[model samples]
Target: MNIQHFAAFRAVMMTGTVSGAAEILGRSQPAVSRLLDRLEAELGLALFERRKGLITPTPQAHRLLDEVERAYVSLDSLKNLASRLAKGQGNQVSVAVLPALGLSFMPRVIAKFRQDWPETKVSLNVRMSPTVEEWVAGQQVDFGFAEMPVRRSGFETEIFSNAPYVAAVPSGHELADRSCLMPEDLREGPLISWTPFVAARHLLDQVLVTSGVRIEALCETSLSGAAFEMVKQGLGIAIVDPYTAVLQADERIRLIPFRPAIPFNLALLRPEFRGSPPTVDHMLSFARDLRDDVLARVPT
Candidate 1:
């Protein structure tokens, strides 16, 4: 299929009419319409229906649109690559981060990266822990920061920081005044928690096994923040990463380092099959700088 025809078809779909697409693409309406026609002929499917001079999307068009938009995103990424290479800015970075890091670390990294490589174009893709590893190993993304362990086949992983896990407890709880807590501390209480699929849970489970301690997950949830709220409301104590511990606004909960120091280590997952892109490499360095800056001020 013709890429130009696809682009034209996409433009028409986005702009709602041939004339509107012409305006956006700076082409004549007839030219846009012809390209769209060529695309439809090739696909043997009508993309739109002409109703009272207005082009309305067909069932097939709507069905195909989501996939087409993803194609456009990839195409746009490639276009930016070409433009950056041609201009020789010597700097551009694209980094994908997990949902947890998006709250705090990613923003600081982006700011510092821009300062060092002012000409760089930074694109941030915030994803879940599972996706972050896949993106790096698959080479679909340049870099990723996640709260999970690195398990992908073609990626190099390192422990940037051993993010100690903490138990968030209500202010009136016996352990709230303490700086650290053990698994046995909440053996009698309900556990507000994260998914069992997560690394944090894995580590906690390991610790529980050796301690012969298993607290009932009376109220479990997928979101760390939401689980924290459950504890703040005196429902249960949750084992959460330090990142979320600091961001939550509820004054009723205290963040105490978990005993046995179940480490929620952070890593930079990079593609193993290919050398990193120049921009992506720069972003990796930027991320390291961001990590160092954060560590300097945080309590040991």
Candidate 2:
């Protein structure tokens, strides 16, 4: 029997009369009786005993009612879960981010996200850009933020930021007084640079080469956060993404625009294979706001 049959059976058992069941089910008394008959025949058990004008449930009906009630309870719970999910109240979200954004920018986004979705847990994975791209391509996380030029096939990517890289100089340094820095300006002091593997480093190298500027690096790091730390210690100045330079800028560091702009591009990656939940979309909204705020505050 189908759900109508089960519904009739439940209604009849609850009310103890076909007329009462009919009223509850918005069907005629004979329609409800027929449903009970079909259900009993399908189950191969007499569910009710009929008297001249009344009905009494059999022991078999009582036993079957227990299972039906449990099933209905489970169905109700499933409906509730679907409702919550549709409203963007999912349990948790997993995100992978490059260190440039993860160090400061992403934290602010998460903080703003929590204000609206405090109950949803957030799992933040801070990795290198390549690792972030791999995680997104492999569907290991719900979404990711990474450097641009993701070659993987299983991602829906959007360019989050395409601002120029900025020169990060230590406070009191000779170059700190310069409002903007060119490739040639780096020659005056030691330069802290990204390792050759980084995509931004390749772009910066292209600009330096095109301008016929070259300088030996005092040190190299794979992470912009580390580069910022090195710059903080007066070790050397660095050219870093605008996000990292703006957020990490403090009394110890100065941010200057880089000439012949080497564009620092960041991308937002979502797994092509998975449906994005409401929480993921909300988190992305927060990220967009943070990107706009940082870009607005960046020095020219």
Candidate 3:
């Protein structure tokens, strides 16, 4: 009939008497008997036989007990799983990230996160900013890091990093000696630039136009990391996000602050329909710390 009836049946079978079952269940003997009676009426099967104030389990009762015991085992396992998940143990955290951060910044964050939560697994998806936003909006991942001005509807965002872009110049280039590079300065050399379709590229173009600077385009790339690679090969100088500059800078390349500060804004996006788990919160804390550390080292 109900959990109480099943419980009574189980206890009586275990103890071999209604009085013993009542003692175990904190119920009166008559109450236990009534539970058994209701259970039998509901199932249309007799679960126990009683005579001269003694009770014995029916054959059907033993079969029902086996099923109930199996159900209880499964319920116990589900409870244990819930407890582990609440404690942030043995779970997976999925995150989508822009290529700029994924190539450099996020790996460090994940390394630090793993030190603290070794049992938690992480799935990192590296994609373009728009794709990262789409994954978050679609709930394909737990959360995402993308360039700001996310245009998706199904996710909430928090500003993760707000820092100015920097110029990555070959170490042998004359502009590398300058304290900072302005849009006008880039006109002196072939410039490795973002593709015209990227939002940051449009912003860079506006700044260049405002500064009355026109530079030769050496090549075009969609990824800041790719631009950094081009700079390292002495192809040309590139204006890149600070995260990429900070991690990918080498002896072959020099990082200089970019004037008119094209701010590279990054946001963290989480699905509105999903709740933040402890694992996600811990990972976010690590990511924020790394962001602050990198920003602090950004060329001013």
The candidate scoring highest on TM-score is: 3
CA lDDT of 46 in candidate 1?
92
How far residue 140's Cα lies from its native spot in candidate 2, in Å, is 1.8
Q: Ranking by lDDT, best first?
A: 3, 2, 1
> Which pairs of residues collide in candidate 1?
none
Q: What is the TM-score ranking, best to worst?
A: 3, 2, 1
The CA lDDT of each predicted structure is: 0.74, 0.86, 0.87
State residue 47's C-alpha deviation in candidate 1, in Å: 18
Candidate 2 clashing pairs, residues 3+ apart or interchain: none
Tens digits of per-residue lDDT for model 3, 183-225: 8899876899999878899999999999998776879999999
lDDT of 1 by residue, 225-281 (tens): 677778878998898766666655467987776778877687777767766666666
Top candidate (lDDT): 3
List candidate 1 stretches off by more than 4 Å.
1-73, 83-90, 229-235, 246-252, 273-286, 289-300
Error of 1 at 193 (Å): 0.4
Q: Please, what are the lDDT tens digits per residue for candidate 2 over residues 185-264?
A: 99976899989888878888888899899878979998888898899999988988888888877899999888888887
Q: List the RMSD of every prediction in angstroms.
A: 5.8, 18.6, 18.2
TM-score of each model, in listed order: 0.65, 0.69, 0.70
